[model samples]
Target: MTRRTSKLDRRLVAETALRLLNEVGLEGLTLRAIAHELDVKAPALYWHFKDKQALLDEMATEMMRRMAADTAAPPSDDWRDTFRTRMHGLRAHLLRYRDGAKVYSGTTFTDTSYADGMEENLRVLVVAGFTPRAAARAWLTAYSFTIGYVIEEQAMGPDPFAGTEGYDVEARAQRLAAYPLSAEAGREMFQDHERGFDEGIGAIIAGVEATLLRRGA
Candidate 1:
């Protein structure tokens, strides 16, 4: 009964921590803050988590658990499509919370379930004729690109052009005149976030495919 109760408390603490992270982000998150939110003392949280990092690890695992679920739904015949869907889901989930990308980056989870999601991705690439090492490397490359892109996109704010609302197109053109290439391509450069994400994902997949083809030949 004591063990059962302890397990229950740990689960509750993890859930509450997740909620706090989504609400306040990592910077403002504290064991005391979470305890107070749960109407319990900070020491009570220590019983479950030794420190803030331990708590964060659990929270990050929870996020990956959700990602696993989102990605595990259906198998796609096209490996690229499967990978892109997973990335899209990840980006959408990360954007749901303030600083969600920051919380996810640089976090490692040894949870078998999350590993299963990655293994599934590896299987897709393997089926596409990639050697295991290449497939794994491609997965990491795609994951890194997706994470980096989301972080930058989030940092750019909701509207990249917000502050330039009053600026006329001619004025913008004049301002960018020194950089003729940028001036000519400025509109395309600041693409819709979704379009940019798709483009990046496509590029990564294409690069991996080209590498595989060259190796095969």
Candidate 2:
């Protein structure tokens, strides 16, 4: 006879899986690994999640749930600042785990909890004078940019210039001689991705605001 799992067992399995994900990353995460981490057999994990994908989905949702909680209670006024702070918080949370963005981007949430967060974001945008449709579009665009940026940022790894660390200006110039404009931008371009991210995010917000204003006009 199979043993029934308690709520505690399910929570342990999920928490254990999260820890394993942090240690081994998405590629290395498996039911067997999670079970071993919990000092239980693989079947014990199946009692909670049917397979690796199911576990991954649960983990991804849990991450979003945390994000919703962390960013849920924003301060009143200054919607722009509120949105920016939320994005920053989301980025910080994703950075906490290995390949976190990869896992988050793979899953979708239509649950009430996530929907409430989305509704709140839209409400903020609408209160800032955006039409409902524009508010929705802006939220979706900002979300897409945030997710895409985080995935690329994480994939680029801790040291983006890992292979090009020793390459001097002249060496870089020679390497990019074929693409003069891109080459002329300098090694600083390769060194400061965070600045690029900030600039891009700023531009997105500005563009959305401009669209809203133009629509009103």
TM-score for each predicted model, relative to the true structure: 0.80, 0.80
lDDT of each: 0.72, 0.71
Model 1 local distance difference test score: 0.72
Candidate 2: clashing pairs of residues:
none
Off by over 4 Å in 1: 1-8, 159-191
Candidate 2 lDDT by residue in tens digits, 1-217 = 1233544355566666676777777788878877676667788677777777777777777787777777756666677776777677777788778778888886755245577777787888787788888887877777778778777666655622232242355677889899998788765544455677677778888898888645844
- Candidate 1 lDDT, 1-217, residue by residue in tens: 0112334365677667777765666678888888887777679788778877777677777778777776655357688788788888888887766567777788766366687777777888788788888888888888888888877776655622232232244556689999988786645544477897898899988898899634744
> Where is model 2 poorest over a 10-residue stretch in terms of lDDT?
159-168
Tell me the lDDT of model 2 at 106.
Answer: 64
lDDT of 2 at 63: 80
